[model samples]
Target: MQLNLTGHHIEITDSLRNYVDEKMERIERHFDKVTNTHVILTVENVRHKAEATVNMRGNNIFAESTEDNMYAAIDSLTDKLDRQVKKHKEKITDHHQKESIPLVDTEEE
Candidate 1:
């Protein structure tokens, strides 16, 4: 999966970039079809905010969190995104299962 990191009003440091990459890598294990991911980090006053958008085959998952620390914000964001991905996966699988079955036709005796 491709990861694009952006900073708004905050400098993108190597350590922060590496931390984001590592956390996003863990998401690959859960969903292999992830096309791309975009992460935006912003700091406003004392609040650090992290937002992540995951692009999948048929759907997109997004999550955001704000905390005092950037690391904590990222952690919370990813956790929320993980839950969204899992829920979406389950919904998609369930939908396919119900739609894939064909109805049988009976002949009148």
Candidate 2:
């Protein structure tokens, strides 16, 4: 999957970028259909915010977290995104199962 990292008011360092990339890579094991990911990091006052947008087959999952550290924020955001992805996948699987299964009827004459 393609990962795009952007910063708002802060300059993104190599280590920071690498850290974000690594963290995002962990989510790939959960769903391999991820096309691309957009990550935005912003530092405002005492709050560091990290937001990530994951593009899946026909769905878009987004998660944002704010913390005192950029890495921590990214971690939290990714955790949230993982949960969202899992939930979405489960829903899709359930729907497909229900749709594919045909009801059987038994009649007595």
Candidate 3:
């Protein structure tokens, strides 16, 4: 998966980037169909906000979070994304049973 990380009103450091990368791995591990991901991190006063949009084979999922710490925000954001991805995966996969042929008796008079 390709991750496009961006920061708003804050400078993204190496540690922050690494942390985001590590968290994203959790999502990719479950659903490998992910084609691209865009992440935005922002700080407003005392609130740390994180949001992400994931692009898959034929769908897009978005989620956001806010917390006192950036890491926590990222964690929450990933958790939301994970649930969405799992739901999407289930939707794409078929789980219904196939029909079997039935025997029939034919009589002509």
Candidate 4:
């Protein structure tokens, strides 16, 4: 999966990039269909915000988080994305159960 990182009023550092990459790996492990991810980190006064959009085959998941620290915000943002990806994975999975199987009549013997 491709990761595009952007910053607003802040510089993208290697540590921050690596941190995001590590956190995002969790999501990729859960769902392998991720095509790309666009992440935007912004700093406004005392608030640090992290936002991301994950692109899949036929779905797009967006999530954001705000905190006093950039690392905390990124962590929170990835957690939200992880939950959404799991939910989406469930939706795409085949849910049909044993209802399709026909019962055999014991009286046939």
Candidate 5:
């Protein structure tokens, strides 16, 4: 998956990039079909905000978090994204199961 990282009012450092990459590995472990991800880091006043949009096979997942620390914001953002991916995966699996099995009707004369 392609990861596009952007920084606003903050410089993107190598360690920060590495941290993000390591955390993103969790997402890939859960869903391998992820196409790409766009991550944005912003510092507004005292708030550090992290936002990411993930493009997957049939869905787009977005999550954002604001904290006093950049690392914390990234952690929170990843948690939210993970939940969304799991939910989306469940929905897809449940849909296929429901469609594959047809209900049988029994009639008594």
Candidate 6:
């Protein structure tokens, strides 16, 4: 997956980038069809916010989290994205099951 990491009021450091990459692996383990991911880190006063948008084949998942620490925010954001991807995957797979069978009726005399 292509990751575009951006910082709003904070600087993007190497350690921060590595941390994000590490957390993203968890998401990839769940869904491998991810096309691109855009991550944004923002700092407002004492709040640190991390947001990510995952672009996939048939769906787009977005998640955000805010905490006092940047690492915590990133962790939370990845967790949210992981859950969304799992839910979406389940929906797509379930749809196939629903359409797999057809019902028909025969008249008896």
Q: Per-residue alpha-carbon lDDT of model 4 for 1-109, expressed as tens digits?
A: 9999999999999999999999999999999999999999999999999999999987999999999999999999999999999999999999887665658755664
Instruction: Give the candidate number with the greatest lDDT.
Output: 4
Q: Which stretches of candidate 6 lie over 4 Å from their true place?
A: 94-109
Which candidate, 2 or 3, has the higher TM-score? 3
lDDT of each: 0.91, 0.90, 0.95, 0.96, 0.94, 0.94
lDDT per residue (tens digit) for residues 1-109 in model 3 = 9999999999999999999999999999999989999999999999999999999998999999999999999999999999999999999899998897677766687
Regions more than 4 Å wrong, model 5: 94-109
Best prediction by TM-score: 4
Q: At residue 6, what lDDT does model 3 achieve?
A: 96
Provide the global lDDT of candidate 6 against the true structure. Answer: 0.94
Relative to the true structure, candidate 1 reaches a TM of 0.84
- lDDT at residue 59 of model 2 (Cα atoms): 96
Cα shift from native, residue 108, model 4 (Å): 14
Per-residue lDDT, model 1, residue 3, is 95
2 against 5, candidate with superior TM-score = 5
In the order shown, the candidates' Cα RMSDs to the true structure are 4.8, 4.7, 4.4, 2.7, 5.1, 5.0
- Superpose all Cα atoms of candidate 6 onto the true structure and report the RMSD in Å to 1 decimal: 5.0
* Cα lDDT over the full model 2: 0.90
Stretch of 10 with least lDDT, candidate 2: 94-103
Better of 2 and 4 by TM-score: 4
